[model samples]
Target chain A: MIRTENLCKRYSRVEAVSDLNLDVRAGTVFGFVGENGAGKTTTMSILATLTQPTSGRAYVGGAEVTADAAAVRRQIGYMPDVFGVYDDLTVAEYLEFYGTAYGVTTPVIEARRAELLDMVRLTDKADAYVNTLSRGMQQRLGVARCLMHDPQVLILDEPASGLDPRSRIDMREIVKGLRERGKTVLISSHILPELADMCDEIGIIAHGKLVACAAVEVVAARANGQRQLAFDLLSGGQALAHAFRHERGVTDVLTCNETSVEILYSGSEEDQVALVRGVTLAGYPLKAVREVGASLEDLFLRLTEEPVLPSGA
Target chain B: MHNVLRGWVLHNPLLHKELRQRMRSGRTVLGLSMYLLIIGAVAFVFMYLNVQGQTLLLQPARTAELFTFLSYLQLALISFVTPGVAAGVISGERERQTLSVLLTTPLLPASVIFTKWVTSISFLSLLMIMTLPLYSIVFLFGGVAPSQVLAVFILQLITLGAIAGASIFWSTFIQRTGWSTVLSYATVGGIFLGAGVAGYLFDSLSTHMPDQGLWSMLSGICYTINPIYMQAALESSRGFFTPTFHNSLVESVFQTVKTHNLTSSGSWMFFMSVYVGGCLVLLGLCSWHLRPGTFAAAVRRFGRWLVR
Candidate 1:
């Protein structure tokens, strides 16, 4: 539902978004992972029709953002980072105002306002002033405001940036619900694990370029194939290392001490279990065994550490 | 056509939302009350001071003078307050980080600018309309005609459009509300005071020589550009109000024009077109500023045309 082709945005001398290409399919959650000034917000803004690219094109719902901006606007709901609410308005009134601004009818807005407030879990606080809500509640209200027009594509930039852990979880669930409702959501965040949990596809953007883009499971599977297995032995650590050094699935075993060894095992969990059973049956001292999972951070570092190609390339 | 008109009248969402928010605001309520109170107090106090140590009677001249005072007072207050009302329209949205979200809706820049203009002018209209009970003082005394009151209001409306256009232009051009407000006031003030001084110099230079056609016409143009001079003429014409005008450059030049066989309404028409045309130009500038890509695209097309 959202696509960018060689989109470049320059502000005076600084290139905020440089030759970026992206494709987000309909009805799937695409997480944009990047650090500050990685051009994530700029890319999202261009897709939302808020910023014009210096060159190339962007489209939402098959309409070019710059040429058919009004149509694209009708098809996408954009939530900006560091947004604010009208302090004088109540939560319901805020949603009602945005609904009206989006050209939603009174009757339609009245119905959607209730539904959206309920969806964001602000139904009970509907009559309360927006300024009275907490930060987390306000962020949720921002999401509700975006969904007020029922746009098919949602452009959310840093939706859970400043929230506490529980609030972040709440926001993650809200996004998960959006996916279930079949809305294409393009969300950018620094929270990789949360994105990993919620996104079907993840794109890592660095230095104003997309370095890696793929499904979460595919990336995780590639990273998970190499396991860091550690074992502490009461004795015979040399025997354990020698026994596992020649094993088919064991790549390398580093003997830490006379009583401990760590193995880099490229094997399935079942194979590792069988190998451990064989070691125990062979009567080598095996006090403990633990497999450490590869974190999203490790993947992010491995991806970003790769050499970036030239812009046109 | 009917649907378009109906949509503009009843279904303009930005206009509706702005009106709702403004009407419910305590600041708006306080502003209305304070505006009415100031006008009432000024009228009563002027009456008391004029009748001090004299027997109070229904004097036509006193009432007429009071009418002029009230009109000038209204003009001054509207001029000063309008920039505050409009200069923050766009920039405040930016400050709140709501501008991007607002733009990502189906609203074009023209629609948003139209809504801002309508909402600000509507608030000013409400303030003007609420002063009618006070204007009834002049009506009860039988000095001012209903048409004169209507004329004064129409002149005020034109002035409102002019100043509101400047405010909107500054609001679009500047990113900071503070700077926009300051520049808005400066624009209005520069037109009133700057044109007043320049018009005076031109009038003095051309008063004795009516045959100096170009100088006299230039002087007339300068006088017409000042909102204060225009309001003074509208208020003082045909005994609508008979107070001594502080700035006589426009009125004096207008009399010279009448001597040269030009109708008084000609002056009104000339300046009406000028103010309204200038307002449209400023609004166009505002729309251009709000949509940056429009400017860039124009530049690109111009470049390609130049090369061709």
Candidate 2:
């Protein structure tokens, strides 16, 4: 749905985005993660055709952004991080303005305006001035504005930034719904866990280069080499610990206390479950058992901590 | 033809948005009312002083004087109000962070500027139209013909376009609205007041010089370029319109055009063309500035294509 070919954008001495390539498949949400000034916005801006890349090229739905910018613009909806509203316009008028800008006819705008307002939950505030709405409502309106043309690709730069917890959740749910409708979204944010949960693929960019890109499960598996399993034993901890050490997938075992045992088990999930049944049938009383894998937060920190390579290196 | 016209009218979304916002805001009403009050008061004062103790009546000569006075006053007001209306067109969008969003759409840079130009002209046109009753009063007295009044409006339209173009150009170049507005006023002042002063000084100096001297030539050039002086000379040449007002320098340009045997209307058209041409040039520059980095990018791309 969106692709960049070694895209590089330089502003004088500063390289805002350099040697960056991205591929977002159709019908999937791609979450872009980066710290402040990490070139996330710059990359998205290039794709949106708001700024020309100093070199290299980008395309949306196979149309070169620079060569066929009008076509690219028609296919994509861009929501900048700090968007401004026409303060004097009511919510409906604001949407109508954008709808007309995209050359949508009046009848279509009228019909779509109602559905958009309902989707953004701004139906009751249709007649109210946009400036009077809360920040969360305005952000939702921004989302609706992007969706007004029923675009094929959505490039949202930090859509959830600066929102309260409830608003953030609301935004998350809205993005999830977009995916359900089979819309391709490329979202950037500082929140790692939210991206991990919502995104089919996550790409981490730093210092103007994409350092890591993979599916959510692949990243988690890379972060956790071995799953840690804990078992609360009714008795015979020493016997169970010995038995666990002798098991095929048990790489190491530890006695947490008289009633518990911990094992670093390298095995598939089904193998782990079967081992639990084996332990129970082997006359070891089992109270409870749990398996722990690396969380997205741990994976994010681990990846970001790696040394960043300069562009083209 | 109908479809094309409808598409042209309906496709310009920015103009619709601008008009809606302008009408809803109290600024439009306040500006129009203030405009009427100021122009109306000036007309009333002219009438009051003309009447003294006698019963108020329209005099043909007084009507000519009123036309001249109101014409100059209208030009001055148009010049003063245009920069305020246009200087914030682009800079205000940037300040509000809406320019990027607008640009990201399929909206062309030309459309953005064209809509702003139309909206500003529409506003100043309202002010120009509201003072028609004042013009009608002058028409009733029968010293100024309908054709002359129409010519003066054509001149006003040219002036409005020129000032609005310069202001929008500055707005595109400058990042801040305040600076753009200030620069627009300064540019307009240089064109009108600054040129007038220079023309006056050179005219005074040429009076003491020989007829074929360099000072006389320089004075003639200044008067030809100075719109205020040109307009004053054109109005003075016609009988009963500002009889006491005389500009020898501008009259020389008029005489030169007449020596070629161009009629008075033709001479005025030749003079007004400079203002109209200048407005087009300024608007062109404004559209260029609105798309920053595009020219260089295109140049680079062309260079690469040629190399290939």
Candidate 3:
């Protein structure tokens, strides 16, 4: 339902989104993971038809975002990162306004407004002023506003950001419900584990470029096959961590404590055994040597740390 | 076509929402009360000071004077209130961050601008209507005709519409409500008042005589748009109101060209067309830039063809 081809957005001298290619199939949740300034919001804005790309093309629901923006808007519901509301209007009035703006019939708007307010758990606050509601309630109201037209696609930028833990859980459940109802959602967050819990496929972006895109379990399985080693000693693990930087197949080193370090190693068993013996024989008082299970956090850290490649690479 | 008209005029969501919010506001109620009170007090005070316990009988000139004073007062108040009402229409939405979500709906940019314009002008219309009981003073004395009252209202509405349009343009051009309001006030003050001032300064500074062709035409325009001058003319024209205003367009244009100056009626027409019509044109340009339509696309294509 959403696709972009080499989408590039530039602001003066800075490239906000550089050659970003993305695809989200119908009826699936695609989580866009990136840190701040990693171009997640820019990409989402392009797909929402709010920002025109400097180069290349974006599409939502098979319509080009720029050329057929009205159609694209008709098909997709967009929730910006910041929750915006008309302060003086009541919750029901706010929803009614957007419904009429979207050309939804009055009957359908009332019916859907009731259903959506219930889904977002704000049915009781329907008559209350929007600004009087809590932040979480306002965020939920924003989601309800987008769904007023019963769109098939939803582009939510950082829907869970700045929410309390309970609010985050509530948002996750709402998104889960959306998926169950067969809506395509492209959600973005800088946090990976949050997306891991909800997304069917995850794309990790860094430096305005997408570095990795895969199904959740596929990325997790790749992490499972990773060869990382952890060490515990009496002291001076920092010095050995410095030494292991030159060690073969030791891709990256993380110093956990003064006496402990975790090494991302992809060497054969022979090299591993040799390294273990070398650490023990080096008079470091090695307490333990164990293989550390790789996680999505480790993979995300490793992927973001690497430099972006040239276009064709 | 019928449904579209109904939606725009009857079911316009933006207009309905704005009107509902503003009508429910305590400030609006307070403003209307204060406005009516001030106008009524000023009129009664004028009558008391001048009449000196005598009946208003045979006081046609005093009533006419009172009518013109009220018209000028209303014009000044409307001029001040218009920019404040309209300058925030678009930029406030942006500051609240609602404009982005609004654009992502099926609503056209034209509808948004039009509804905002109507919403604001309709409130001004309500204020004008509220002053009618006060205008009854003029009517009771039998100096002002019913048609003159309607004419005065129509003139005020047109002037206010033009000012509101300029405010909308500023609202669209600027992103923040604070600066948009500043520029909107500047536009009203500069266009209406500054035109007269600048024209006077030019006449003073120049060696050329005021009766010459271009200078006289330009000076005529300077007064036509000035509300004070238009209302002043409304007093004199109350006797005739230009019976020949229904003259053929060609004859009017020919007379304007032959005289090298605008007639009284020609002056108002010129003022209305230049201010209101010019605002409509510029506002259309701003809307097209905000939501580029087929005209822009076609222009780009034409440029490409020229390059080819």
Candidates in order, interface RMSD in Å: 1.9, 1.7, 1.7
Task: Put down candidate 1 lDDT per residue, B1-308, tens digits, no spaces.
Answer: 88865566577777777898899889999999999999899988987887675645777777777787788889888998899999998888888887888777766677778788889999998989899888888877677888888888888888987898889888888999999999999988788888777766776777676666776677677777776666666666774545554446534644544443232677778888888998888888886777666555566768888999
* Prediction-by-prediction clash tally: 0, 0, 0
Candidate 2: tens digits of C-alpha lDDT, residues B69-127: 78889988998999999999999999998998998877767668878988999899989
Mark the regions of model 2 whose C-alpha exceeds 4 Å error after superposition.
A223-293, A309-313, B1-10, B56-58, B201-221, B237-240, B244-273, B292-308
TM-score of each: 0.87, 0.85, 0.84
Off by over 4 Å in 1: A220-293, A302-313, B53-56, B205-212, B239-263, B293-308
True contacts kept of each: 0.72, 0.81, 0.77
Sort all candidates by lDDT, best to worst.
Answer: 1, 2, 3
DockQ score for candidate 1: 0.59
Q: What is the lDDT of residue A121 in candidate 1?
A: 91
* Better candidate number, 1 or 3, judged by DockQ: 1
Model 3 clash tally, residue pairs: 0
What residue pairs are clashing in model 1? Answer: none
> Against the correct fold, how does model 2 do in TM-score?
0.85
